[model samples]
Target: MDCASRKFYHKHEFDCRDFLEKYCADKPDMEFAEDALQFPTMSFHYVFSSGFVKGDVLIDISMGPLIHHLYSACDIFKDIIILKLNEGCNMETSRWANTRTGAFEWRHTSAYVSKLEGKSAQIQDKEMKLKEAISHIICCDFENENITHPVVLPLADCITSIWILDAISKDEDEYMKNLEKVSKLLRPGGHLILIAALNTTFFMTGGERIYILKHDANFVINALSKVGFVIEYYAVQMRRNDSTLIDYEGVMFFTFRKTK
Candidate 1:
């Protein structure tokens, strides 16, 4: 599909459950599991464990209701605030956070994270801690001056945005604008952890072709510099599965600090 013909992610209703099944499920045979699940899980574990980003409040701006990456952050950050672009994501995330019936099962992912910490037996405990740490899940508009308008939030110590910019931005300028907006949520010298799919044009989710901004590592570095963020650490996980669902070369993880 052409760029103009492709579906804009923020304009349509997202099938959160379908997205979880396609990418976040624990099935070993799932084609994009390595790129979508294991990479972020491992990266977040390492970032948090290394004490590279210290903070009490963590603001998460992600594409959908994916929470597997936050398991590690919840152990370190006392207050976890999630900002979603749509109410569907909010409800879906709330279902899991509240442990309501029909919520998508995440025990398998949690078990993997626990094993990484060498405390596999504390899976349930980890889940409970995450649930409690998540103080709020608010719907937001990145274009607005106050992304979380009508409910002001204190500047966050750390912010983690995973794959949202790639899926939502229509071009490089919009991506930079979105990045700048997200950076405003962090205090000076605070950290921003970004995980992006490299050189991706689009992704297939819920039988729909969603547009993803195509950009390389250099472009991202330049954008961050323009937004006053300095990269502290960088890592990339090369694509392990030749999945036709997404046209991504690899996934890049960056730990950046706001310089001003």
Candidate 2:
């Protein structure tokens, strides 16, 4: 099955506002290290806020229209290019970036992240920065592994993808292969921020079951190592027992830097 044809983003309500409300509104009982959403945001904030791990360009591969992770990137990088699998995700993202009314509002998410970073009053300010930093929303094919082929894009200084491989891959082999292929987009010594669901095979959205490639921490660690990345930070948040939402044991966030 063509991964793009699955149209998960089209059916799912994956707006940033919905994501924050559903997964991040309430503080987790566990420490920051054990909270999936919080951990990723905090880790990103800590790293990028330090003025380290920054570059002129950051490319987001298979981003699926989610800008939650871009909060920190916008502050650290001068330009952001978002590459997605299909047009639907691109359209939705463009709507939000261009501030079209009725588009999913993400000011709340910006405000929350500002609060996390001790800049509670800079919510609107950060939103404006995010809007300015995002320079492009283009389509790319992960399976092809030639994201900017025929017209190569400037090598990215950092790449961030969240649950993109699992959501699109048919199996572990495909997932690993795609990971290596996508990692090529980064320049040597560039950073990679990855967030994935642990041991999850499926998620529900719009009354439909969306299948994903099941994977665990060991698999991901080995996969990245094999593809010339060194892990810098790793964390996971155990999933709460919820029959109503997705069934996954946990969410894992990993920060890696390309070595070769």
Alpha-carbon runs more than 4 Å astray in model 1? 1-4
Question: Number of clashes in every candidate structure?
Answer: 0, 0
On residues 70-142, what C-alpha lDDT tens digit does candidate 2 reach at each position? 8988878899998877776778788989999766666656766899888999898898898899998887776
Q: Model 1 Cα displacement at 15 (Å)?
A: 1.2
Model 2 gets an lDDT of 0.74
Model 1 lDDT tens row, 1-260: 65667787777767778988888887868887777887899999999999878989999999889899999999889999999999999999999999999999999889989999999999999999999999999999876878898888989999998889888888888888878788888999999998998899888778888888999888888999998989998999989988788899999998999999
TM-scores for every candidate against the unseen true structure = 0.97, 0.85
